[model samples]
Every structure is written in structure tokens, then in C-alpha cells.
Target: METVSGHRPTIIDVAKRAGVSKSTAARALAGASNISDSAREQVLRAADALGYTRNALAVGMRSGRSGMLGLVLPDIANPFWGEVARGAQDRAADADTSILIFSSNRCARKELMHLSTLMRARVDGAIINSVADSLDDLDRFGLPCILIGSSAERFPDTCSVGSDIVQGVGLGMDYLRSMGHERPALIVGQPTRLARARFLRVVHEHCVEHDIDPAVLLIENADYTVEGGRFAMQRLLARNHGLLCVFAANDLMALGAMSAVREAGLRCPEDVSILGFDGIQAGAFAWPGLTTIEKPARQIGAQAVAWLLDGNADAKPGTRVHLPCRLIERGSLANLCDASARRVGSVKG
Candidate 1:
């Protein structure tokens, strides 16, 4: 079991040390179902003792798998997506697979290009976040693909994972209404984004069910960026100064809206209340901690990787998994139902 000079211990070394054949060592290390428990234990102990590591490239070549997964995101700069990437990376590492990440910058052409590049690279599978509207081209990629943060209905044959945007929006609206803010406006993301459409639809349905005034149900489209959020908030304020509360689709936009509120000589939770989505870490440190519907971005990312690794083997085509969102109460929202001096404080600058 002695290794050659300057050479790494190989499967042969593990086999000789464990008194098993090379094939047996490989099967034991791979945790193949056919390997006996006693033999597998012996091989594992010998490999640990000899410090033997299987060459992943060689293993992939034999198995016809690259042992790599691809992840495509709309914007890596967004902290929400950063958390997703972290989760995916951790999960991939656990399975002894590497990940190649591509940021599409929310461009359809770039997304397609990235997918093609991944295909050429021979990635075993892929997980796409916010896939483009039309998925006809994705069908030919010849890879096991999973979609995140987008509707499964749009891509019926692909496995999809994401938060229930409609439910998340409803939760935000109900919380705002409970706080006595009946006239709340929504700062939405681009119309091309599926989450945006789902959020708006749910908001409108909630309004209809509650008989809310149509005039107070204001909606403005943003680019899902901090700057975009600020611009959308400015527009909403200019159009309607009477809005007591505002909800932004994501935390970045919500933070931007808070900046705009301050520039307008208004105080959050005092002159106006603010609510946000995505539950990013930065939101917790905002001047008045942001009230938000917390989407488990990391968990979603991890689960997406798991689904891809499992190859959706037993699941039917077009399996959709929707993670629940929770409402996190923070300093940014004010209760309008409170009739004390604070209630007046909430209305005045």
C-alpha cells in the first residue's frame, strides 16, 4: 500500500490495503447499492488510513457525468440571489459535485447563451432562477433542469421550486390591513418577471375580496433594483401623498423607497409605513428594520439542487414545489388601529 514518490494515493492503494479488488473499492467508495456493508466499511477505513482520494475527472469519465451542476441567476449582485448561490454551493459540495454559476443580468439572450455554454461544458444538470417567459428553447438542452422563482405552469415539463408569491403577497397585504393601513400602494417589479405578475394578481384579488377602495390600490413597476425602487416610490408619492403604507416587491426596492421617503421629509413608520419582500439580511439593519414577507431564498436554492441531483427520478414531469413565506414584523410598519398619541405621531412628519 505504499505510494509512489510525489504521487497521490489511488484506488489501487485503497484496494490493496483493504484486501479487496479495485472494482470492489470503487463500488464501496461510491456507496453503490450492490456493495456489502462489511466490505464497504473495510474499504472506507482503508481509504481513510491511506489518505486515498478518487479523481473526480476520472470518475466522471467512467460514469458519463461531469459531476458538475450549473446555476443561472438573474442578478448575482442582488443579496437575495447571493444567499441562493451560497445554499446551492453548499448542497453541491455535500454531494461531491461542483457548481458553475452564470449571471444573466435578466436578459433573455444572455440567459440562452449561458445555457448553451453550460450545455457545451457538459454540466450534468442545471437550476435556473427567473427563467425567461418563453421556454420552448430549453426543451432541447438535453439536461435535467430545475426552475426556481418562476411558475411551473409556464414550463410544464420542468421541475420547479419557488416561494408562493401569491400567498406571500396576500400575507403582506393582510398584515398591512391589520395595522390599519387600508390605502397601501405596491411598488412592483418589471412586468416580464413572473413573480411580479403573480404578486399583482394576488393583491388585486385580495382587494376585491375585502372591498378595498380602488383608488388606494396603486401599483408602480420598478426594475427590482434599489435605484428602481427609489424612482417608483418618488412617482407614487408625487401622484398620491395620502398613502399611509407602501409595499415593495423586494428588499432592495424597499430600501430604496425608504431613502425616497426620507428625501421627501417623511419618517418611516411615522409619516408612512413600509413593507418589503425577500427578507434579505440588509433589511434587518435598515434605519427602521424593514417589515417583510420572508422568502427562504437559501432553502429554495438548496432544495432546487437536491431536486436536480435526484433527477426528479420518481416525480412526475412538471413537478412544482412551492415553499411558504412568513411575515416578519419589524420597526418599519405602524399600527393605524392604535388611537393613542402615537397614532397621531404616525400621521404627522
Candidate 2:
């Protein structure tokens, strides 16, 4: 067939070539299940042959949906967040929808700006893992939204999907105690951050349960980064805190602390044992495999999108979902009961 004179190919051109009505071509192209598979395939083949392209804007206008969702993340560069984004993208693709991802770079202003942009783009909903944004900011986003990560607990009356931090904290504390590390040093963020505060609270509770004195517990405030952990470890070493076991807030900090131990002319699990949270893949391949409580990175992302797209009745405002975390035992932590114990580890370590 010769090209249509003086015009681009349209659904009519495709329908004519496929020997089907225009409405049938439209339904087939839209992936309407009412059409038979054979008909859909035929229309698709004709459209491909004719080089037909969908005007997504027009389609969205007709359907009153943009077929896109917004994802606002604090830091996209982090590997944990990357896994979450991948999970969300995968789930969105399942529903024939796309995701518009924006990184706030841990800035409240930037997060609010991204939300505004998402609104301007007419996204169906948003999934936010904000760092500095307040609950008011989320309310101002004025869209169906689901909070992600530990901070979700800080905001009341909202739908959220996050890892069970309390469960994870207990798991970490229990494992450390089981390893015979009672006075393990804690490396975490400032006391104000809800996640860190929550973690510390659980640690205190665990101490009480195990008949340990919480006041003598070693603690070092660190950023959630390798450099931060390194500096914090260095500071703790300076104090001569007799570090035996150190548990960091995340894998990055734990990895950093490991390097610090070496710099101080000490050996890991020999002079000091280290435990980390966040079972990032790098922990598995570290020099000493790091035992950690693995956060549900991908699950939270997928579940958030699922709740948003599925419109489940129970996924109402104020609904909070906490997926469980698991412990990945590796070589980083030392077993004090072992015959080869290098040193007698104590609680104040």
C-alpha cells in the first residue's frame, strides 16, 4: 500500500490496513481486554507496520488519567533507595503505568518543589520518602500519597509502607547479645531523628530485658555515611572506650568503622567486633561479611505502588504497613564463646 497523501499515519490508516473498524483499532491499541487476543495482535501488527505512534497526551485526556505516578526520594544515589525505585518501577510497569522519579537531595524545599512539579505533570499519586519535609508539606502536596521508610511513623493519619524498624532493632540487639556482645558500642545519627531515636529506645529496652546497665552503653553519633562512621569511630577510639563490638546505623557506617579499626592498628572481631544494619549487597562482599538486619527496601516500594494503584479499600488514609526485616548473619560479628577468641570481650567495648 502506498503512503496516505499529505498526512501522517493515524489510527484510521492502521484500521484500514488491518481491515478493522477505527474503534476496534483504538480499543486494541489501548490494550482493552474486551477485544480478542487475535484482534489485538492484528491491530498491533498493522500499527507497527504503518509506524503508528500513540499520542499519550490525547489518550490521557480521553481517559482522565496520566498513567504515571510520582516517586519522591531523599537520595536516589543510595543503593538501598535504588532497589526501592527499581521495585516501584517494576510494579508500575505491571499496571501499564510509568513512574516519575525525583530526588530531593535531603532538602525540604527541593522535596516540596518536586511535589509541585509532580502535581503540574498530573501524576495519579505520589510515594514519598522525604528527609526534611514536614507532615504539612505532605498535606500540601494534595495528592494520594504513601510515606516510605522509618520517618513514616512520625506522620500520623497517612498511608505508609515501611520496614518494621522496631522488629529490626530487636533482631539486631538480640543477635548482638547472643554473640556475647553486651556493651556493644552504638554508632547512629543524632538523637533527634525519629529513626535513630526509635533505635536507641529499643536498644535501651533490650538492655533492661538482658539485665544490662544502659547508662554505661558506649555510643557515638555519626552521619549515615562511610566518612561519618569513620570519624565517629576515630572519636570513640580517642576516648579509649574499650570498644569490643560496635553496631552502626547502616552498612556504610559499619564499613567505615571497619576501616577505622584497621587504621587504629587493630583487627576486626579480634580486637573489636562490628555489626551493621541495612543488608546492602556490599556488606556480603566486604572483607569480613557484615551481619546486619536487612531492611525491606524493595518490598516497601512495590507495596506502596500496589496500594496506590490497586485502590484497596483498606489502603485508606492513616493506614500504616510495616513489613518485617530479617537478619543476615555473616563474618563481621565475633563469637566470644569460640575457642579461638582473641580477647575477652566486655559490655563497654
Highest lDDT: which candidate?
Answer: 1
Screening candidate 1 with a backbone cut-off below 3 angstroms (N, C-alpha, C), the clashing residue pairs are none
Per model, how many backbone clashes are there?
Answer: 0, 4
User: Model 2 clash pairs?
Assistant: 158-318, 183-347, 243-349, 244-349
Tens-place lDDT digits, model 1, residues 36-74: 999999999999998887776677778889889999998
Worst 10 residues of 2 by lDDT: 340-349
Cα error, residue 55 of model 1, in Å, equals 2.7
Model 2, position 190: C-alpha lDDT score: 74
Local distance difference test scores for all models: 0.85, 0.84
Residue-wise lDDT of candidate 2 within 1-349, one digit each (tens)? 3356857789999899888999999999988989988888989999898888888768877897789999999888777888899899999999988999999987888988898998877788999986754677666656788889877877777788998878998999888877788788889987766778888988999899889998988899877888988998887777775647888988889999988988888777777788888888988888778888999898888999999997741358788888999999888888876667656333232
